[model samples]
Target: MTLAQRTPAEEAPAGASYPDLRWFPPGTHITVRGLKKAFDGNPVYVGFDIDLPKGKIVSVFGPNGCGKSTFINMVAGLLPIDAGQILFEGKTIAETRIGYVFQNYREALFPWLRAIDNIHYPLRLMGIGKAERERRIEELVAGFDLKFDLHRYPYQMSGGQQQTVSIMRSLVIEPEVLFLDEPFSALDYEMTLIMRDQLQKVLVARGVTTVLVSHDLEEAVYLADKVLMLTRRPSRIADYMDVDLPRPRDPSTLTDPRFIDLKARTLEVFQNAVRAS
Candidate 1:
């Protein structure tokens, strides 16, 4: 399962510019086929295949060590695929602009830089002009209605604030394929609720095709337009479910009979996966 470790080098070169972003358009659906990966000769994923729909939130649910992050990292071009293709808009991952939010918000954002600078960092790397960079930041903040003081440093802000910056950083580019690896796992109860609502609003409005990995059943069902249930190691999609719930999912969505039923079904499959593994 070992391939060349330098696959990331094949992506858009460091000095290259970010491509034009299409606003209000649902980006391409990602198509994966015969995907394979291994770390230190240990297979984590094998023949993993799924089609992530356009402008939809697909929450990936699985037990611990199921290679959720690994799958996403490979798609984000942060890690190389040993075998198979991950296609989006007729191009490979290396050819596309990707947005990834790591689970560890504490380590994701640079401590020395201000929150505004952190959001601006990705745009900076892409050689975005100051004017254009400011425009992107303004659009993202205003669109999300985020009120965090970006002038403060990451260490100076609350955990929720720091994670918000991480999310903003990942999203500044408005990538077609956005990978959120346990994006809210570090937040408090109140912050989680806020982030979930905020994420739904922005993503739904802009129509980014998001893939989220989460352990929280309620959160998964709450935010997802669909859910991809994965098995244990050497993971594969056990079931693909359409949410069938109404939009603008609020606190009331939790009490809806359909939501409760779907949540229970997802949990049962997850528990079965844990034991079968």
Candidate 2:
């Protein structure tokens, strides 16, 4: 239970603790105990327990509608947990500083606002001063190597640019935990690769605990320190794979024997879940 405070871009007070996660040990930033959820008498999750580690990326993958998004949404408080608890130490979900990047970038963006404004929107809501907001957004843009102009409206940008804006919006707050729901699903293969690298870079620099939902096997392994594979109805974590690939990953990483083996093993887990269902 000794995580260091996650300071923001040159602005957090000297020696201030980031209360969002500093109290928890590295391996249990968010603990879900006996979690359960259902809709109309049908269960999605039952008696599920998992520990989301501090400052590490955990990717969740499973068959469609197997409650991956539902799980994270419950954790994020977008929806209520039917039972059990999701907690950061003793804090409620809302007490934590959380950043969420939804799967649909276009829908999430403010059409009338410039990309920069959209990214700055959340900070403004939190009452962050203009100068401090600029510093944080600037850090995110520079860290991600975003080259696109942010003055344009969301409708004027391409899918990738819009998503990049969405990502920056999530990161501007320097959240203690970040939730990404199929963040790259809208991009093409090349753009997906580019976005993945950008995400990894910022994550490394920020050291935020992250939970990602990805459908792509390669992507799950590429971005995660560990992959949580889910089962069908009455959803549960069917298996877990710790990805040990070297950092600063590239296309070449996909070819490494280690990466290949990890993907194959994860794919097998999903395949078995399918058969069992």
Candidate 3:
């Protein structure tokens, strides 16, 4: 269905309405209300409410051990929500095409497949032909700056290299929504910044709706358009702060007062969650 078919929330901005949600494509207009989850009777989250708009980058933040990863997994359909509904583009989770990049590079990439083959795996599953798959893979490898060791196995590549391949594999099929669970945590400080900048460009260019979970406060504020701060587990959103600064943002923009204000606000919410926990 087109964006025009969607019924807009009463508070949506002017010239922006449902059935015409072009501003937030790929991403779901998620209304997460009363969400709760438990494993073996241990509750991780409860009574959460969040509105994740389309095409926007949302950073899910909380103190360590908060249900940030669990929340992301539930949204990605890797884990089932014990209670509450996850709506994607006004549809159920089953209707969305999600790409998940796990926290660990070792787990996300395959040791058995070559880089190109791994990148092509999803496209092949989607029934894309050989020529198209090669074209897509070439584009991804170049865009992400994959090494010439394309035919080498994951074990042969460095940590950063494996991560680049893993990320490329996830993006090959152009998922409707992308979940990045600390995709840069494994990289060294310098590599992290480089990858962060590159990933931001790629996500914006592809118009992919992205939800990122990261412990790096600066990274969250830098990469996300909105920050969703969660209370410690059983996790719940304490505050949602929008980063009103301009887009195609440079890392240098992090030094600006507006960006600093947003970061400070986000940290305050995090501190509140910690104390409340």
Candidate 4:
């Protein structure tokens, strides 16, 4: 029988065990069901299920090798899944417009292209005309309150600047979903703080559904509307906690009682997940 004709009970083959088919909750932008992945016979995800909310930043965090990157990569269609389905607003990945910011900014950006052209590359690929691409770049430049010259090559810019260009390139497409994998882990403490605030501002203003894979617990909680923690390989959800702390979070928010408390709770869950591994 076709999927549309099958009831939830009929989703699995007769006499076989399977996860119940569940509908996406209201406001869910991404739906992952029965997701499975393996590497060299080692399972990374098995029957994983999750619903990420629309226009919200959800941070994925956990112990080392918990499939945080794997999860996002699968969702982004950068890596193929072994089984099951992932959809954006009920549409398949190929039908969705998505952007991804890799952790390595230096490699992510093209050294040969000026920063502006780098940002324009994706737009060009999408068949956007020069005038329209210029318009979008200007919008991003204004939104980012950019100070550095876009005429410079990636190798000439500072680490933070290069990362900013990478982000702009990803965003210039005006994607429906954005994935960031440890975008700031390479920066020094001060630069990391700056980028965090800048990124938070633009993301909130744009209201894009974002999935972030971060190793730093503090960064994860600080930037997220919800924190999705994962257990080790064959990964499952360890904890999916909401960050009720107000937005436009700043340096001071780091020390806010609520932020501190939530971060501690997330850390506790993370530690437990690690120990269980």
Candidate 5:
């Protein structure tokens, strides 16, 4: 469907009371209220609510099968929300320009396309000219430090390399809102750290509104400005936390006392959610 033709669930009435977060950024905040979904008569989510501000990183944490992925997918217009409302940048979720990075890098990147070509594909889809596309691809290649010889195909690249390309592909679209569905879940220990650091820089530099769905506690602490901890399937928002330490955080921050304190609080909430379920 065309961008303008898309629509989210419905509009809020005039003067409806809702939380406001205009202090963060002037454009593109994601607000979800009473979101519910079911598949094959099996309920996955119910009454989930969150307000993500622009230019901020929001991490979503939940147990397995809690519908975190489903939540993001519905926001991306990949699936329909059975109930509730989702607003993006003061517009319906369907009308927003969003970029999605799937949990599996191999599934998201085209195996047949070269690194540069894969990055260029979205530009082509947008009808950008050859010159501009090539220029942007060159910038991305340099910025990501992509190898010259490995531009052949996705199969030739390492897991980490494929992930870098996947992120670049999503960012190249200049999406106002980006959804990363466990993009680093498959990487090894060292690669995960490297990519996590790199992703923080990239997202910060662009002021991208980001939502990351991850189970890694450290990752959620390192990359997120606010972490939304959710309950198990038939899920709901359990707690919304603000990472108040500082900016330009490093992996070392995970070992800090404050980080430990924050993690402990989030874990307590998670455990309580489990017991309640």
Candidate 6:
């Protein structure tokens, strides 16, 4: 049977079946049902379920080794799950269009290709013609308000610039979902701040369903509409807190009482998760 036809029992994880059909919350964009994974005989996730909302940014933060990157990778279909099903708006991964921005910009971009060419590569793979590829690239360049030249090779550009290209490449496809795994971790403090602002503008404007995995607490709360915090191994949701802070959040937002309080709360949950581990 096709994925869409599968019953709730069929969608359940191995050895753990449920009769009730999984109910997605309103505006849910992605659904993960009974997700299970293991490596070297050690279980990471077992019977995990989550409903990610449409047109919003959800940041995944947790204690170290709590499977933040693992979660997104599995959802993005980069890594295989041992069992269970992940669907995008009731469609399987093959039927979904996705974009991923890896944390390591230096390794993610093509050293030989010009920045513009890197952005065009995915479209080419999708059988998009040269004319359309050029049009999309032009649109993204304009949307990003790019100041630097795109003709330069990745090796010649600064770290922040390379990451910018990586983001643009992911976005060029206009994917239904965008997964970013620590996209700014390598940049210096000054550059990280700038990239955050740039990313926020494009993502909010496009309203793509985005899942970001970050190690930094402040960065996680600053950029997210909701923060999904996980517990230690055999990870479970510690808290899925809504970030009600108004956006176009600037550096000044850091000092806002609400922002500060939310960050403190997130940190507290994180510390408790760690201690429990």
Give one digit per residue, the lDDT tens place, for model 5 in 1-277: 2222333324534565445423224444887767889899888876666678888999989777878788888888889989877888667866777788888998889998897788899999999999998888777566565444546798888899888888989988888999999989899989999899889888988899999999897788789999988888788888889988786888778888999999999889888988888
The CA lDDT of each predicted structure is 0.84, 0.87, 0.81, 0.91, 0.81, 0.93
- The residue pairs found clashing in candidate 3 are 3-19, 3-20, 4-19, 4-20, 5-19, 6-19, 24-54, 24-55
Ranking by lDDT: 6, 4, 2, 1, 5, 3
> For residues 110-183, what per-residue lDDT tens digits would candidate 4 score against the true structure?
89999889998999899999998888888888899788999999999999999999998998898999999999
Model 5 quality (TM-score) = 0.87
State how far residue 62 of model 6 sits from its true place (Å): 0.6
Kindly provide the TM-score of model 4 when superposed on the true structure, using C-alpha atoms.
0.93
**TM-score-superior candidate, 3 or 6:** 6
Error of 2 at 239 (Å): 0.6
Model 6 CA deviation exceeding 4 Å by range:
1-22
What is the alpha-carbon lDDT for the whole of candidate 4?
0.91
Q: Summarize candidate 2's per-residue lDDT along 1-277 as a digit string, tens digits.
A: 2112433324567666555533334567888877889999999987888888889999999998898899888988899887887887558888998999999998999999999999889999999999998988877777878677999999999999999889888888888889999999988999999899989988978999999999888899999998999999889888987887889788899899999888998989999998887
In model 2, the Cα lDDT at residue 108 comes to 90
TM-score of each: 0.87, 0.89, 0.86, 0.93, 0.87, 0.92
List pairs with backbone clashes in candidate 4: none
Off by over 4 Å in 4: 1-22
Residue 12, candidate 6: C-alpha displacement in angstroms? 19
lDDT of 1 by residue, 82-124 (tens): 9887888657877888898899999988998999999999999
Which candidate's lDDT is highest? Answer: 6
Which ranges of candidate 5 are over 4 A from the true structure?
1-28, 145-150
List ranges where model 1 is wrong by over 4 Å.
1-28
Q: Candidate 2: which stretches are off by over 4 Å?
A: 1-26
Give the per-residue lDDT of model 6 (tens digit) for 37-152.
99898999998988999999999999989999999999999999999889998899889999999999999999989998999999999999999899888888888977799999
Candidate 3: segments with Cα more than 4 A from true spot? 1-28, 145-148
Q: Candidate 1, clashing residue pairs?
A: none
